[model samples]
Target: MKKSYCPIDTFINVIKGKRKSTIILHLFQGNKRYNELVKLIPDISERMMSKQLKELETDNLINREVFPEVPPRVEYSLTDLGKEIHPYLKGMFKGGIIFENKIDSEEN
Candidate 1:
């Protein structure tokens, strides 16, 4: 695979998908089951959610635990690295809100 030269590019690559940051933000609240995450993010399809979760797992930002049960329950939580980046992700979320409000005000 081609390597990214800049640290920012590398970081961005991990969270590039539309739902990645949203997933992280939700996990920041606490560990969640697959269905719970799907419920929290209304617009995302199950297939896309699975894809993003797999990518996040590959990046070491989230942990997936499979329970030994008849139904095979699965839960995801943030890793230490993911916890560390929570503030930055939160900041981006706030900035997005500000940006949207600014644009709305400008249109009036």
Candidate 2:
């Protein structure tokens, strides 16, 4: 991530990819496998999901563990930094809901 004078910009830059925040929030629940993430976030294409996961891992926001078997199994979980950011993300989630409601009311 690029250095920024504004801390918020740094935060945004780290989580600034398609469904990146969504992936972090889901992983906050618990560890998830690749297929489970796909199911959880059906709107994201498999290619995009892979890209986002790699980026998150690079940013140290999530952990990717691979288990060897007949077929390799990969799981994702939040790292300490990822967990630390959850409250901020939840605040943003709440703020989004408030804005959505305001928009709906304005349209009505």
Candidate 3:
């Protein structure tokens, strides 16, 4: 990928899709199958989940491994690149809490 003038915009572009960040955050825990991901994130549809997974795979953020079996076994886990960004994602979680608290206080 070519270097963008705005580094933050470039970073956001990679993870801009719906459910992308959440999906990555989940995979940070460990590998998960398609159904497992669906269960973990109730609001997301199967189609949307599939789409986001493909995009993440394309971006080299996650790995999708398929096994030979009667029913195909597919699992998703973070790639080295993905692992490299895990700390930042965790920091986002902390910032999210702070943002949420501010919103709550404002509404009260």
- The C-alpha TM-scores of every prediction are 0.93, 0.97, 0.94
Q: lDDT for every model?
A: 0.91, 0.95, 0.91
By the lDDT metric, which is better: model 1 or model 2? 2
Please, what are the lDDT tens digits per residue for candidate 1 over residues 30-78?
9999999999999999999999999899888999999999999999999
Worst 10 residues of 3 by lDDT: 1-10
In candidate 3, the residue pairs with backbone N, CA or C atoms under 3 Å apart (3 or more residues apart, or in different chains) clash, namely none
Largest lDDT belongs to which candidate? Answer: 2
Ranking by TM-score: 2, 3, 1
Model 2 bad stretches (over 4 Å): none
Residue 16 C-alpha lDDT in model 1? 83
lDDT of 2 by residue, 1-108 (tens): 678899999999999889999999999999999999999999999999999999999999999999988689999999999999999999999999999999999999
What are the per-residue Cα lDDT tens digits for candidate 3 across 20-60?
A: 88899999999999999999999988899999999999899
Cα displacement (Å) at residue 11, model 1: 1.2
Who is ahead in TM-score, 1 or 2?
2
Global lDDT of model 3: 0.91
Query: Candidate 2: RMSD over Cα atoms?
Result: 0.7
Clashes of 1: 0
